[model samples]
Target: MIKILICFSVIFSSGIGLNLYATHHQPVNESNALDLAANSKSAILIERDTGEVLFNKNAQEVLPPASMTKIMTLLLVMEELENGKLQLSEKVRISEKAASMGGSQIFLEPGEEMTVNDLLKGVAVASGNDASVALAERIAGSEEAFVEMMNQRAKQLHLKNTLFQNPTGLPAENHYSTAEDMALLAKELLKYDEITKYTSIYEDYLRKGQENEFWLVNTNKLVKFYEGVDGLKTGFTNEAKYCLTATAEKDGMRVIAVVMGADSTKNRNSDVSAMLDYAYSKYTTKSLFDKNQQVTSFNWLKADQQKVNVITNDSISILHKKAEDLTGIETDVKIDQDISLPIKKGTAIGKLEVKKDGKVISETDLVIEEDMDKAGTFQLMGRILRSFLNK
Candidate 1:
């Protein structure tokens, strides 16, 4: 979820390239054992917090993402939940269109009703095309509208090569994304954290105690077979071949890896596994701030509130090669100086940059803790006048 935005109306930089002393760092090797170049059409591995690229092969090549398209679907669903526009307990009626979806489904009957929670389970654990359409219809009033939302979001994230023809990664004429873009989507989706509760489940019964109960299993098998590997998504198509976006957390550092257009499932898994191995072996992270931790504050006579707290939008970290020396590290915080009021929550108020040897190694946005509206004209004058008199 790198180096990507999870909030509405947010923009992200492509992230730092760690040229810190310009040592000619390269994460890819065709002759090396990583095998990402040989096993997959496109692939990328990145640190979740720092958005640092560890290794990449054909990362920007646009290819069908298959079922991994649901990563954006899940991201939008989580945003609705976080914004209180949707609730997990809410119920949705299955539409005929939703029920008629082909390829990898939970088999929802027409007119059947399911909770948003269960539909998420179906989509996350089963790659349910029907469930994806169900949630899409509920959120945006139609699958077409939801697909529009998905494309708009992709643009907002500054993803250049991604476009959505549908919510499920079912084969479609114009539906495609790059490995780097898919990794960013997974990074954005992972900010919800609660998503793993569904994505990590290897097996579960969807309609328990019912005669037509459906058994749902995760398409991403690494969650069950690999230690610390929790989620993401897997896909296969006659055209797209096999794909997987996988994440694992070990020793407090989480990493995401994406593989697209592999010839077979075993190769797909092998490629991602090798990518993960490369990340864990070569790099480690230094934590700076936990998510939502206060970094600074500001007060102004023109604001409705007397003061506003600035905090990190997400946890901040610095990535380093495991054997690299730790020295010459410094952090710089710069808050916006130009005065403006009525800023909404999640608005970037400032920047935090970490430099090593006077070069920026990492950067993250610092945001306001809550909304701030303008102060009354008279109130602002009074504060300014009082300050002048006191001085």
Candidate 2:
């Protein structure tokens, strides 16, 4: 009888005890590799959703960005639209300076009028230099002032290797950017889906009834040739060579590719396509948690609820190899021990860390699932008294 009792006790304790045993472990295969530009000066391919760089070559080396600078100009315009300072239907009159501008142009005659929508299409689809200048002037009163705003916005975006001499990306003495910086700018631009509506159009007519009416064809040929390819811009000059910022989406994954100073447009298009194909083929996104999913429980102080549910702010997904087994993924949730009297719903209180083989690979914010109002003084005193009496 004594031996049997001892054996039962050991079994019960072992079953109840928490053990730090490894749940899953697997090796990642790296057989898949990305194809790159042959005669390209610099190139980079990034996962759009997660901002992960899958391939990079000379990405940090600063060089002339040519019309790729227009990406930033469009970004600032979008910012204004988002802030309610400008509207798409609002008409802007072309200034004398804008009308007189040389190079790729919308042929805006002085005092000619066009909607913001048309100007955006002119710049995005046709890479119209005059339209860029006209928009810049209308937005900031002068091209020089708009250029200052562009530089300031670049600094705020932390584009370390980017400098802008003009909004139209006309070859200036000092206009320059790096593959990495252009990638960063492209990533930001992708956030504005409205921009793609213009960039992706293969052909369109601008200024239908005006004397400046002109037919426009998208300069970025990838939008027409490559599947799932949308935005963004293409640039070329004797000095800047051929530059393109292209984005493509496949199987719920979006990828951004930047190529600067390609020897030819054909090479630029091919490089971008190869890099995008490599990204979609090798990696897939895995969602770990859904929005509002309960990640953990935390104690609340002086509140009606004893415990609060910790929820995820947004659904989180990470890029992983297609063949790699997911049995190795481990999730750990960490929360504050005692949240103070007042806690608001959606307030970030902790973090959920996802790991593979004890190495943290991804993380998401943990938020309060529900609101907890502060207790009144009387309620607080009553709770204190109750606690003392129980003790």
Candidate 3:
């Protein structure tokens, strides 16, 4: 076993692919081995579907996220929108405190009303401090309360290194996140398609046709310049420096890349672009099976139903490098010898493990696809008699 510790500043500028583990404890096939390094303080590139880290550099180093903190803010808004607690068409009355927020705003005035849709646009496109505070206050009744919610949600998401001091990514002591944490947040935000509707817009008008209509443009320029790039956030502050958490999809593969604490905008964009380019150029995503795809069937012990179908609870996909032959990869499905009665539809019977060159690459739970009820004593005896007679 070889441990390769990569320093990005030296090797990344040359565009060399580092044969780093796309994930820890799993080895890519020799043919698929590639090295990736990025010139940034902290960076990570992950496949969205599988959450595989194609490349990482100081990914766990906690740092101020600046406006990228709004990813969590957006996540909370998305949660409210998804649970039907908030509506896009519903109007939110701006508070004096919200309007008083500093840096990157749509210039919302106190007592002015804006729909949730427009407010989301302001946060996603303009990186609006005022808009973020308004939505935060609307959801949690106060920015401080909303920040509490953010921390709670972070805990739920198992993000240990993330903390939120404010909703709008303002520089504050003790408010910081790791690239890994921010990338995870970006992944959660992508679950809501409505977010992309605003993040993808290169330019649009807020309060259209009004006397004080504000022209909103996306702070993340990669939306226009990079192919397959759509929605994400960018950040910069004296403390946070230039940072971006970007996501893009191409040919069924979605990637999330985070670059934080860059020296300049050019450096930040370049580093993110390089990480994304490396991911797209080197990998291909392949789904092994769809959810409910039958793996095998087995007779149930002590069940009225004679057989239970085993299947995958969710689809499984793998990111293999272009040069590698997926056929070379091995899959072994390990299942229980006898499935017992009273089985639930999603009960895990065992697991399917994927290996490349003897190293475990991925694993998915194998589950019973349908419920199995226990059989009465008489019924079990009758079935046994029938089976014996047939044999």
Q: Predicted candidate 1: what Cα RMSD to the true structure? A: 5.8
Worst 10 residues of 3 by lDDT: 7-16
TM-score of each: 0.90, 0.73, 0.74
lDDT (10s digit) by residue, model 3, range 223-267? 999998997999999998899998898987889989988888888
Q: Candidate 1 regions off by >4 Å?
A: 1-34, 385-390
> Model 2 over residues 62-128: C-alpha lDDT tens digits?
8999999999999999988876888899999988889888878878889988889989998999888
Identify the candidate with maximal TM-score: 1
lDDT of 3 at 264: 89
Residue range 1-391, candidate 1, lDDT tens digits: 0022222121122222343321122343432345454788888888898776777787889999999999999999999999999999999999999999999999999999999999999999999999999999999999999999999999988888999999998999999999989988888898888999999999999889999999988888899988889999999999999999999998888999998889999899999888888778877777778999987665655677877788998888767677766654567787766536677998986778766656655677889899988889898888989999999
lDDT scores for all predictions? Answer: 0.83, 0.76, 0.80
Model 3 pairs in collision: 17-35, 18-34, 18-35, 18-36, 19-35
Model 1: ten consecutive residues of lowest lDDT: 1-10
- Which model scores highest in lDDT? 1
Which segments of candidate 3 are over 4 A away from where they belong?
1-39, 289-315, 328-391
